[model samples]
Target: MRRICVFTGGRADYGPLLPVLRAVQKDVALELRLLVTGGHLVGQQGMTTERISLDGFRVDEQVENVLASDTPVGVAKSLALGIAGYAEALNRIDPDLLLVLGDRYEALGVAITAALRLLPIAHISGGELTYGATDDSVRHAITKLAALHFTSTEEFRSRVIQLGEDPERVFNVGAPGLDNIRTMAFLSQHDTSKLVGVTLKTPVITVTYHPATADPQGSGRGLRGLLAALDRFPDVTIIFTGTNIDQHSLSITKDIEEYVRRREASTRLVSSLGQAGYLSLLKISSAVVGNSSSGIYEAPAVGTPTVNIGSRQDGRPRAKSVIDCGEDEAEIAAAIDAALRISRDDLPGLSDTPYGDGYAADRIVHILKTVNLKPLSCKKFFDLPDSYFYMCSNQRN
Candidate 1:
């Protein structure tokens, strides 16, 4: 059996990867090894590694490298520690391939160590753009290191090929998180309200705003502006999910906490809801109000409307369900009021997912099962002709 190492760093990152991970685990010809670290171990982030245990995954290693400091320097130091820890663990396990998802800093550390060891890496969610945060650069860097790419959309697959990766090795696997949505039985509306510690009478706004924290000063002033907007709607109940660990991540979480605490029963602040429960909440939510990627990608799969704030998701594709708003409090309040006015009967049914269907796990497993097991080659750079470069630079498509 070929050993496949799947690394998950946090709750948000794992939600999209879990279906693929389970596929590898049940495959007869594959040995699945899970490495849980980062926010999974952090107490404040719900310690989501427990979810892995509950799901019956065989964890091979856990590295605790997350720090309380939410600054650029702190992020660098945390990455360094992750690299060291992952290097030691990889040396012992010596898997045939290291699988990772997304472009977070923690995943970047795993990519670096795997590249240095000449281990073949299969990266999902590559060839995407998110210029608001440092994640954009980190995603591209991981793409360069990865040998096989499983993109969430055809557009993204083309972007990977444009980045110099061979087209034959790249597969458009759709969004794996959607696979879980198709398979899992979400809690009923009443049960979901119970789990969230709220009565079902008032409208529920599922909040998941995160700071574009890689900015120079990492201020969540936009998020603060969002809270200020929410204060206008006195009857709505805001179920606020916590922020991630980036520069100013703490500030974002703190601001959310203070806003919710001051508002008391009007807002309920919970750190993490595990993936399944959160998706269940998405099903019945009046509107998913935030700049988090969940609003752009996952919510639409379940027919949920999103109120995306500011430039965080500036250029990404959107469904008709999303309502984009500026950073001003009045504009956001107006947008939410408009969303609240949207009749459930008028809401469109879940359409064919542009990001993907629920088949990413099968496609990813097929590639991993059939790929040649030779050590990945990273020395060659894609050679572009001067003519092509000039045309591309001049905006001639």
Candidate 2:
């Protein structure tokens, strides 16, 4: 049996990785090794490793790397700590292959460690662009490091090849996160309200706004503006899922707590919704109000309209279900009002999601089961003409 190792740093990665990880575990030909780290160990972010055990996946290893300082210094220290921890873990586990998702800093550090260890890495959701954060660059970097690539869209697959990965090694298997929504049973309206501890109001909008991280004003000021706009809708029951761990992540979380306290009955603030609950929340929401990729990738598939704020999701494709706007209160409020008008309950005719058809996990699982890992270790840079530069003397004069 091939030993397949999966690394999950926190809520975002684990939620999407869950279905795929389970598929690997069940396959008779493969063994699953789950290494949990980063935000799973952090207290304020709900220490979501508990969610992992609750969901029934056995974690094989744990590497604690998240730090308390929310400044640039803290971020750097976290990365250094993650690299050291990952290197130590990789040596101890010595898996045949490493599987990582998305473009987070944790994935970047781990990918480098695996590459040096001569372990073939398979990367999912590669070749996507979101210029607002440093993550954009990190995603492309992982593509170059990985031996195999699984992309959400065909366009993204092309971008991966453009980065010089072999086309035969790349697969356009769509987004695995969609697999959960296609398979999981969600809570009904009454159950959802009971689980969240409030009677969700009509025109329920689930809000999760993260900072641009690289933005000049930081996430706090812009998120505060979003809250101000949300305050305008006193009657709307708004569920604010907290911000990620970034420079101003805490500031935004604190502000949400204060705002939710003042509007107790009308608002709810929770740190991590654990995948199933989050998808169920989207199922009942009138509109998803946030800059999260969930608004772009998963919301449209569930037939929920999204009011996307700011340039965080600047370059990604959106379905007909999304409405883009600035961070200003007036603009955000107008967009929310427009989103509330979407009448289609589940998946609009000609849906807005360009991600996938919800069978990504099955496809990815099949590839993992059969793909040859020996040759994958010897990778070649398949450079495209567009990616090369002509030195002044190399050009015909």
Candidate 3:
């Protein structure tokens, strides 16, 4: 059996990795080894490793590396600690392949460890852009480190090839996060209400915002603008999810907590909602408002309109149902108004996303089971023909 070690740092990557983890475990030819670390072990982040156990998956290893501080220095220290911890854990588990998703610092540390150990790495959700955060650079860096690539769209596959990875090594398998919408049993409106500790109400909006590490003003200004916009609609029930452990996250959390405290009657804050509750809430919500990738990947899949605020999700391909707006209160409020105006009946067709049907997990698993691993040992950079560059230059002229 080929042992595959999957690394999940926090709730952000866990949702997309859940389907692939299940597929790997069920395959007789594959042995699944799960390594949990970062925010998964942090109490403030909901101690989500327990949730993994609740889902019937055994946690093979736990590495604690997230520091209590969210500063750039603290995050850098945590990344160093992650590399050390992952090196030790990986040496003990020693799987044939290392599977990682997305562009977090923890994921980058593990990928670096795997690269130094000469272990082949398989990356998912690569070749995507989040220009407003450092994750954009991290994602491209991981793409270079990985041996096999599973992208969510044909456009992403092309981007991976442009980065010098061989075309054959990259596969456009759609997005695994959407798989939950198709397969998992979502919570009922009542159950979702119970999970979030709020009564069901119309004009409900789910908010998830993270710090844009690349932004000069940080996440606070954008978040304040968002809260002000939400204030414009006092009757709308707002459900806020916890932010990821990024730089300036503490400030963002504090801001949200204070806002929720003032509007306790109409607002709720949840650390983690698992996959079912989150998707369920999306299905019933009037609109998903925030800079989270869920608004780009999963919301439209469930026929929910998204009010995407600011440049955090810049350069990502979005559905027509996604309304982009600036960070000003007026801009955000206007965008929310536009999103709320979208008719439910007109959404399913209008939200036709380029991310494929929700079978990405199956495609990723099939490639892992059947692909030969020997060629990965001698990885090479694919060079585009000179004519390709010449054609680009001619087009520019």
Instruction: Give me the overall lDDT of model 2.
Output: 0.85
Cα displacement (Å) at residue 247, model 2: 1.9
What tens digits encode model 3's per-residue C-alpha lDDT throughout 1-397?
Answer: 9999999999999999999999999999999999999999997789999899998899998999988999999999999999999999999999999999999999999999999989999999999989899999999999999999999999899899999999999999999998888898878899999999999699899999999888948456789899999999998999999999999999899999999999999899999989888889999899999999999989999999999988899989998889988888999999999999999898882238778898999999999989898787568999988998999899999
On the 0 to 100 scale, the lDDT of residue 175 in model 1 is 81
Each model's backbone clash number: 0, 2, 0
Candidate 3: RMSD to truth: 1.2
- List model 1 lDDT by residue over 1-397, tens digit each: 9999999999878999889988998899899988888999998788888888888887799988987788789989999999999998888888999999998999999999999989899999998887677788899999999988999888999788889888778899888888888888988888977877776455879898877755433235567678889988888878988777777778778778888888777678777887788999888888899888898888888877889887777657787788998777888888998888777766553453578777789889988988886735553556555886798879964
Off by over 4 Å in 1: 216-219, 375-379, 384-397
Give the worst 10-residue stretch by lDDT in candidate 3.
346-355
Q: Is candidate 2 or candidate 3 better by TM-score?
A: 3
TM-score, prediction 1: 0.94
- Candidate 2's C-alpha runs over 4 A off are 218-221, 345-351, 385-397
TM-scores vs. true structure, each candidate: 0.94, 0.94, 0.98
Candidate 1 has its poorest 10 consecutive residues by lDDT at 213-222
Clashing pairs in 3: none
lDDT, model 1, position 251: 74
